[model samples]
Target: MFAARRFSLYERAFGPVVTPITSIRGLLQDFTTTAAYDAAQRSRSNDDYFATIHHISNIVRRDIYMERTLNKMCISKIVNSELVYRVLRSCSRSGIESFRFFNWARTHHPHYDPTTLEFEELLKTLARTGHWETMWKVAHQMKVQNLPISSSIVSFIIEHYGKKDLVDQAVELFNRLKSFNCPQTTEVYNSLLFALCEVKNFQGAYALIRRMLRKGAVPDKKTYSILVNGWCSAGKMREAQEFLEEMSRKGFNPPVRGRDLLIDGLLNAGYLESAKGLVRKMTKEGFVPDVSTFNSLAEAICKSGEIDFCIDLFRDVCKLGLCPDVDTYKIIITAASKVGRIDDAFQILHRSIEEGLRPFPSLYAPILKALCRKGMFDDAFSFFSDMKLKGHPPNRPAYTMLIRMCTRGGRFVEAANYLVEMTELNLLPLSRNFDLVCDGLKNCGKHDLAKRIEQLEISLRGD
Candidate 1:
């Protein structure tokens, strides 16, 4: 009778000796797959994915009673490695967050071993986000595992360090090529050199180039150009020019723009004649300056209060069969306006039109403002009238300057007229500008003009 009662109690408590293990496994699989898919779909942005992961992690921690035992939590027993990888990929855009999640995966889900590809993906995310220290740790872990690191991965790390101005770290990484078992390539040397040059470490950079040559890596145009640019930036114009000549001797054509950069450096250092001589020499050497480079020189010259020199430069450039671009025309006209040479500015406008170049609104605005500042209202208005005749009415900036100048000069009636023109052109002045004109009119004892300006402003708002 005792045995019978024991059997009956066993039946009541355990039901059967066989457990539904397959069913439980299936449920866990479904839960993980559904959770991953739902989380990925819900993540519209990096921040969104981060929040989703945070929420899911909280639930897992609470459900697992992981408060005091997080490091020992067996999340993989419920979630699976496939689901973890998918989650990692989905949150890839948020590199830092992805890294945190990766750590959580490794610590909380000890059974879920990451594959080589998984580690690579994480490394990529870290590299892109400039997480170098973590990247190094991950790389070291891979190294400990005897996994092969790719050339592209090394290049990326070098380039990342270079761009961040971490010259020493970049150099250190490059030097570890043999340890990483990655062969050196010209591309890798270029990246290392670029980083060194970016920080103005020309001596160290040249040393690296020598090492590269010893390693059978040929220096390319980019390598030389970077060195030239570095010297120019460091105010070593003579050294930069010497490197350019050396680059040419090596049969790698140095970019014409490098000469332009040197010219700018010379001009800025107050070597006016030297700058001009460089420009002429570059052209004489068959290194023709492009339109953009020519404009840069002209603008720099104008800013240096050498407007006459700029005009002469413009004439010289025209003689070379290189027509002036819109920027070139703009600078010349601006220089002309700066010295109260309104007629010369007008002549440039006419020349640009004859050459079929349509000046931008920006080009016209400054000239108009300069004219108004010099009390040349008639000339400014005449220029505006000519622009209208050519189907290019004055834009908002031009109108604003004209109205502000007229009001400040105590011409309230003229300000009101300008406001009316703006309304007719469907251009509304800012409320502050309107207020300026209104206050000026009222102060000048023109109550009727001020009221009209207020009505015009109200109409602009469709009130």
Candidate 2:
């Protein structure tokens, strides 16, 4: 009977059961994937496009041997330039996988070459990930194909090199742009100037500016703005102000971003009086600085022990009919909380909500945390409940804070309930919270409850 059974199994191995279960599973997956492919092709939503690209790239990265199969299954029929561009954009986080897919598409497929924007995205991915060897290979591919190297690409390369303090490398790239057939435009000049200033090479940047002038490249407002920003960030307020004045005299207004950078720099350098004066000047000159700029000044004032002045300034700005953004409210709320004026914080919260501003979780966290630390559990829980009622529930940090507070106060049951809620919400409580809860429960002689909670925590973690 055993011999007859072995012979039957051997015959089946050469028949319908020849293919393994794994192979069958793969076939089923391929069938499902075809449906996904059809859906992806018909998708018009940006989120769907990104998710599709991410999904395809993930498959390619899953197994070295599966890339060809995945490409044949999904990417082979893709001929849309817009779709390809979106795929390249989605590859920003996975440089190697992106490079592999790009190479496979370009070499094996032969129907799709990298577009200019695709190449740009690839270079950006390469730059962000420090994949210099592959970057060089991609650049060589561009060169071989006689692709027109863009000035923006040149600037991108130079800016990245400058960030790494590789000034010589950036300079070499600038000098070699002619070899790449990229024209040295005024924008390119400004980019190089910005790179020099980024490395604090003001002397080198000034020389480059002179060279640009000699080359008949007129410096634009961006050029002066970069210089002003560089100097301001370096704490050379005098130089920054001089450049700002120079820009104005040359019939160029420093952009709002530049103005904000200058304000932040001044406030950070303890030049509060100077920063306030600049804001006043800006308002007088018909340049109403944004709320964020004003927030920076207010925060600096609060940090300098002038919380009252900061609050007054916030109110005065609102009276000017300029809507205070979430950032502005956060700054004032934080300042009030720091001064133990929880009532003031809540008052501002109500006023902001009454003014039709949506309160995000970020706006609630600091207030909840501050109240919890002050032993004002009633007020903290009140705000937490209000957050949920307003359809903006407290997130991980808020819950963690409450859990820790409860456990420390020997409220083990409350802490465990919060922990359970965190697990249900898929928010992992901090390790310290677990420790505190376990120890608090044991100290209360709830040994069985403690054990059960420990097992629940383990199960939640899939251990």
Predicted model with the maximum lDDT: 2
Q: Which parts of model 2 are misplaced by more than 4 Å?
A: 1-140, 161-187, 199-224, 233-236, 257-261, 265-288, 296-322, 420-435, 445-463
- Kindly provide the TM-score of model 2 when superposed on the true structure, using C-alpha atoms: 0.62
Error of 1 at 228 (Å): 1.1
**Per-candidate RMSD vs. true structure?**
21.7, 13.9
User: By summed lDDT, which 10 consecutive residues of candidate 2 come out lowest?
Assistant: 9-18
Query: Candidate 1 — worst ten consecutive residues by lDDT sum?
Result: 9-18
lDDT of 2 by residue, 176-258 (tens): 98889998888888888878988899888878866876787777767776776677767788877766666567555545655
Give the Å error, residue 20, model 1. Answer: 74
What tens-digit string does per-residue lDDT give for candidate 1 at 1-463?
Answer: 4223323432332223223555567656876877776776666566664564565555343444433343454445544555556666665555666666667777766677777776777787788788878888888889898888887767777777878888888888888899888888877888888788778888888788668767777776567656665676677878887766765676645445567656655654566667778888876765656686677678777887989878866776677777787888888988887887767777787888889988667677767877788877767667777777888877888788888887777766666667767766778888988899899978989787577667666645644
lDDT of each: 0.71, 0.74
